[model samples]
Target: MSSSDIEFSSSDYAVQLDLIGRVNGLTAAKNFFSSLRDQDKTVKTYGALLNCYVRVGLIDESLSLMKKMKEMGFLSSPLNYNNLMCLYTHRGQFEKVPDVLLEMKTNGVSPDKFSYKICINSYGARADYDIMEKVLQEMDSQRDIQMDWCTYSLAANYYIKAGLKEKALHYLKECEKKVGNDAEGYDHLISFYARLGNKDDLKRLWDLQKSKCRKQTNKNYIVMLGSLVKLGELEETEKLIDEWELSCKTYDFRVPNVLLIGYCQKDLVEKAEAKLQDIIKRRKIAIPNSWSIVATGYMNKNKMEKAFECFKEALAIQTQNRGWKPKAGLISSILSWLGENGEVEDAEAFVKLLRTKVPVNREMYHALLKAYIRNGKEVEGLLVSMKDDKIDENRDTMKILSLQDQNSEVTG
Candidate 1:
């Protein structure tokens, strides 16, 4: 457009600034804003830059830019103020959020639904129910403001957190009235009812959602499955999984993972493993975390051999699921078990696989030494590797070495 002599509109510049921030980061955004002509620095462009600052969490820069925007009469809309309030909320400066709302009102800017919601949330977060109620009342009394399900649902959530069951139910009823065939609203209400352990309501809303909404999304299934798991309704969870599997066009392991996790939490790890095995037998895709979940459950039950088997299953297909690493404590426990009772070859293979995931550490060396000593294998090569890894001998290392020496004496 510049080459064609087309002038850059203010909206264009604003959009370009946002894109720069997202694609090239804050420094590039700043450079672009700085390079803009003075006339091009309209309210939209300036607000865009402010959004960039807030998005990146540059608190001081956001405030300074906000001040500059106000000085230049660019603070007419409530958007910039809302951005600041959101920033403060994300930063956990809940106390400062209401003040921003007050400032917006005092500046003669009409607060939007979002502005009121943010303030209500701030008060709720601080657990100031009285003030939260007052803010809700104030928002309700606004002649221009039309209350929505989100505000009511948000209030219900905080009420649930506060253990005000009656109030929570009341607000949830209000939220349901406003839901009016919206899937997301139903999802929130379902989750809240689950939190309250109201299974009847959970089933009711889910049924209603399935009938009213034309298509159930994966997210909806995930939420419902998670809710059932939370309520310990494993039987119902299984039925729902079957329902989802039949209808779902694409398979998502997360749907069953909810049940897998539920099984583990309830100490029914064998059931979880069975379910995973069934999925595997059907040639379905399962992530490492799925196996790891079962492994963790077995570990809790002191079934180290079963845990080791599950852990190996997870490690075998780990490359298929990037960014997944076994928990360090889990690995340590497995290593200790292998050193005491596992084959030397098995320990060596496990440690070799472990090196790709985590750095060389004292725990790895110790596990290998113990396995070698127990198998009556030579320790010279292992000691050289440990020294080359620069892991200095500690008390535990010395103890393991002492054991190796005693084993040698016995052999000699």
Candidate 2:
């Protein structure tokens, strides 16, 4: 809607202020909040403005706002306390999180699930498992509070990180029981199972999620496929692809990209290339990243010709002006090989394309120079070209030019 058509109330403006600040529009949000301050504003407006400061990572401003909020009796809300706790957590001051929780309690503000979870995370991050458990136990003991699946899943995550597999498994089971058709929850559990190498558990949960969800989404397929791939079960992932093709309503290249990545990861570049060709033959679109992965695999195998072709395919598939640049090392490898072996005209054409994506580095110029020297073309002309590109002649460039001149004198 046009600005003139939209007249936001104080609360609407407050939410907008918070949103703007989140996107790094702090100056604009601050000005708008200041304008609202002179008019009628509620505690919610103050809270939103404080949230803006926090979202923009203005720590000093956030702390000042917190003090102002307390003096104005706006600290009675759990949201204000939680925001401070979040700020401390974001700043890596884990020790400060518990203090905020304690202050909240002393102020007669009951800790919500989020408050307790944040405190638990703080302790878990410090590997203070004893205190983390105590906080969780305390949360469970509260008559007004009911434990959530998120807390259990979070506990499981930390336990997994800490190498407490038994406790992690227990909490994971608890979390699974509370999944309740939440797709993200299922994805989290699947990823955790992949980390734990619990293949049986992963399969069971995948089936359970499929039965619970009304219609499996592309993301669900991708997550499961990725987990299977991580477990080195490429055969199973391919079978699932068949199932997904039958059920999916729309085509998203990312669904099969997981398999392409997996095959390349295993050094099976041929299989990955075969899959890519199959997709093309079937008239389905594949993403450039898939081709790049296979290219990387070929590079690792020292198959520069195949790698260069795959890399070229990746560049050709990109939409106009997509800002895609291949990794630097990959570009260097292909250019160096092309200079040594490719036709001089082909090397020049490819280097021309490469310049569009990367700056003219000394190494790339060296390649073009070597290409010209090897093909008995004008090495001096390439030197002039390098000068125009502002690339100074290095020792290697001098060596190449000197050797070419010596060969020319001997032939004359």
Candidate 3:
């Protein structure tokens, strides 16, 4: 069979090109699009190719494509200009965002609320509060544009980022008024309120959400619990957990994990352990994250034995071939501590376990070397393994080797 064996209409071909772009198959999408002659190309086809370039981070290609699009008289809509603004933002060229917005208006493509919102974000990102406010005011004054909760919430987020707490709170209140029983909108407010540390407002909004929605889903409960935990209101979180257990339709460990981690963060390791034990007693399988949190808690309190036990439990339950990586700092600390004070066999076993989660890095090799030298074990094979892994030995490795030399001399 040849490439000509396949038959596709222009619309079908264009649609497939767009689908390919959506899946990030940029090369295939561009090649397929380029094969079509000028007569077969539509504005949508051009837009799809442009989107493909954008999705693949081909900024220069996208810019050239935009020029071609304008020459073909298809760049008349705000959507095309919005794409440029988005590309600029993604590339950290924030200052160029408002320029694209201005060009859109100059070309007689009436700016939509999203266009204005992007400009607002651009200004806010640069910390130009005055221009951001001006853009917001102009957006509000536009008769055709009805400001939505998302836009207001976006503006509130920028205000918070700028440390303009008063202005941020004002916009948050406005965002709340525009919410109107939108679950996602309520969730956004809950998150922002958590950041602002306004427990009272968070509680009030939580109540409002419950009353407006027919019943809370796991998402709703999780968001609310997360807020309470951030506020360090563990008592309230516990009560809410009990309530959720009674009312929830499904059992999700995520909700309880939030509080358990919170307890550990506050140095209440015993409480975290009890919660973990309770979950296991109920025949629920705890995730590696749950055990990792307890391990972190023990480490915080300087209980190395308990911490190692918890870390072992975490590794035992770790899912293989999943895109999960433990905290590199925790891994380094535990391995270093163990190498300094643990048996060589134990260090080797833990490193083997860690390779199942993350790639073998210099830190792991360093820890293993320290263990081997401290226990008077041969390290020639370990040095060869490090070279094979392409991890260069640094000063720390030299120090470990020197320690081995001293130990051998003393024994001799």
lDDT of 1 at 189: 93
**TM-score-sorted candidate list, best first:** 1, 3, 2
Q: Write model 1 residue lDDT over 1-412, tens digit each, in one string.
A: 5578878899999999999999999999999999999999999999999999889877899999988998999999889999999999989899999999999989889998899999999999999998998988999999999999999998999999999999999999999999988999999999999999999999999999999999999899999999999999999999999999889998877778889999999999999999999987875768888999999999999999999999988887788688897898799899999989999999999889878777989898898899999998988898899999998888988999899778889989
Question: Would you list the rank order by lDDT, best first?
Answer: 1, 3, 2
Candidate 2 yields a Cα-based lDDT of 0.85
Per-residue lDDT of 1-412 in model 3, one digit per residue for the tens? 1267776666666787889778758878878787887776988788878877777677788889999888989888888788888888888899999988888888788889879988998998999988988998999999999989998898899988878899999999999989998988899999899999999999999999988877788888889998998999999999999899888776777778888888997899989999888977875667788888888888889887788888888888887315445677677779879878988888899989888788889888888888898888999999999999999988878987899989889999
TM-score of 2: 0.87
Please give the lDDT score at residue 110 for candidate 2.
93
List runs of model 3 lying over 4 Å from the truth.
Answer: 1-11, 19-28, 380-395
Give the alpha carbon lDDT tens digit for every residue of 241-342 in model 2.
Answer: 989988878877778889988998898989989988997787565667767788888998899999988988777776632656678888889988987888
Query: What TM-score, over all chains together, does every model reach?
Result: 0.90, 0.87, 0.90
Give candidate 1's total backbone clashes: 0
Which of the two candidates, 2 or 3, achieves a greater lDDT against the reference? Answer: 3
Off by over 4 Å in 1: 1-6, 22-25, 283-285, 323-325, 356-362, 383-399, 409-412
